[model samples]
Target chain A: MELFEEQGFEKTSAVQIAQRARVTTRTFFRYFPDKEEVLLADADADAVKETLVQHLLQKPDVTDTLQAVTRTLADFDWEKLGPRQILRQRDAMIASDPRLLERELIKQQQLTDALRDVLCRRGTAPDIAELAANTGSQVFRTAYRKWLEDNNDGDLTTITENVMSLLAAIMARGPVPATAARLP
Target chain B: MELFEEQGFEKTSAVQIAQRARVTTRTFFRYFPDKEEVLLADADADAVKETLVQHLLQKPDVTDTLQAVTRTLADFDWEKLGPRQILRQRDAMIASDPRLLERELIKQQQLTDALRDVLCRRGTAPDIAELAANTGSQVFRTAYRKWLEDNNDGDLTTITENVMSLLAAIMARGPVPATAARLP
Candidate 1:
């Protein structure tokens, strides 16, 4: 993150990064094939999928299945890292370039797909599974955004609950139907 | 799409594309900075938002607002590109690599944000706006997937309606609260 901020991600050389960390270029190469890998180091879509699936399997009810998945996600702790390091790395990666952003977005999509698969396995109607996964992901995202803003205060579980409630209200209200006459 | 399929996006030289398309490289550059641009083209986020806003303003009731937005979205017709070309391009882009897939996700995210903004502008609560937009996008995506599979026969309006009904049912059978039970 420091290197990326000092000199652009495109400009920062692997050799320079190794030198700064007092490691050999060979050692750096062993850890990451390219500099971009450093930004994408936290890519763990499979692990998340596994966690969600395990939780879903334990719950038979469809709604319980979703709640279990949400609960599992809320339990994740990205706090082991020093707060300063986490913020710096996040900012550097997202603000650096389009490529990094694209990679991050792809990882998120993979996570969403995994969630959808879990829903399907739980016997949700195919279309319902797709909608549930998509809706669940959006709620998770909103909760994450809130958590990031004030990580010191609210728990992820609480924020997620609020998001879920809000989603329920919106669903109850529902979108306007097409058969309803259109306004001029 | 043909250029990308015939020659890899990276390997296909700009000069070759211009020659094959019977246009100067300058003209190609004017339209797209790179070959990747051809696959990434879609409805402008701002235009879609503007259209939704216009639709919302026409509606007298909050219930009609989302329906209006769905109607506007359904009415959109991609300029003269046959169904086959659309399907091929969509499949090729997503299948080619993760990068393109990421861009597609980001594009969808942008659309969601625009929809949320439009909803908020039309007097919906902030949380409701966000939830509505997320749900609406999910509906649109489900409908689109079905439409694509069925050779794009169904209108977006019908797809949106199906999705909305699904969401309503899910909420009617609301899941147990996540906070109801504490971790043992």
Candidate 2:
């Protein structure tokens, strides 16, 4: 991370990262295929998604699949990934580079798909699972971004709840006239 | 679409597509830079986002940002791009190709950003605008995918409303215990 930040992501090499870590280049290849993967690695994404799914699966009630999904995500020890500053830098790097952003989005979609599948296995209706999973993830994403941006003040779960409330309020505002006419 | 399905996306060539359409290859390049763009073009994406933003701007009530966002998307004459069958084919091709899927996801993010910006300009609080825009786009995405799959029976607006109702129910069921304690 220090090297990537210093020399820029594009300029850094996998061998340099390995050497800095005191590992052989071959060892680095075993863990991550490329330097980009070192920063935006899929290595941990699967494990994280699985951990979240297992947490959601063990929840007392998932009838509120959205709550369960968002809570599971928000409640995770995200600090385990790294300090907020590092995560923010990682995100900024991904945002600035299209390839990294694409990979990040793919990782997000995979997480959403995993959440949807777990909800389905828990016996929520398929369509409901899909909607709740997608909506909850989106809500969490907004909260997560804000939590990262706010420096030190806000809590993730509270921000998530507030975002959920905003979503509810938005829905409560009733449909626009054009589509309302068509709704049964 | 037929050529892509028959020959496979990777195997098909832009020159073949242009020739089949009885247009010069230069004309094709002018319209779409490559074969992938021919399938998932950003050329139309910007225009569509601008159109949707304008539609939302014209609505009688922008306070219901979610409704306005989803309705603006669902109410668009999607057939203007192509018939449902051709659109579905395009989507399938994109889904099967990683490059195409990355382009599609990027396009989706751009649309979401545009919606958020439009809501902000309409006087919405920034956080609420972000959440509503993301949530609304997610809901519309669920509906759109289902609409594509459900052969002959569903209207996009109705499906979107159903998905929104599912979201409302999910939120109403209340938060799970762990996060509830964290919420005020």
User: What is the per-residue lDDT of model 2 for residues B24-98, given as tens digits with 9 covering 90 to 100?
Assistant: 888667655577767554467888888999998888888878887888899987777767876776677567655
* Candidate 2: residue pairs that collide: none
List runs of model 1 lying over 4 Å from the truth.
A1-46, A57-65, A80-97, A175-184, B1-71, B78-85, B88-92, B176-184
Q: What TM-score, over all chains together, does every model reach?
A: 0.67, 0.77
Taken over the whole model, the C-alpha lDDT of each candidate is 0.61, 0.77
How much TM-score does chain B earn in each model?
0.61, 0.75
Across B23-133, the per-residue lDDT of candidate 1 in tens digits comes to: 678866765667665644543445655665676556666654344445555555533333544554554545444544665767676776776777777787676677667
Q: What TM-score does structure 2 among the candidates reach?
A: 0.77
lDDT tens digits, residues A53-95, model 2? 8998899888778888999999998878767876776677567
For model 1, how does the per-residue alpha-carbon lDDT over A93-162 read when each residue is reduced to its tens digit? 4534554556566766677777677778777666766766776777777777667675366787888878
B-chain TM-score of model 1: 0.61
Q: Between which residue pairs do clashes occur in model 1?
A: none
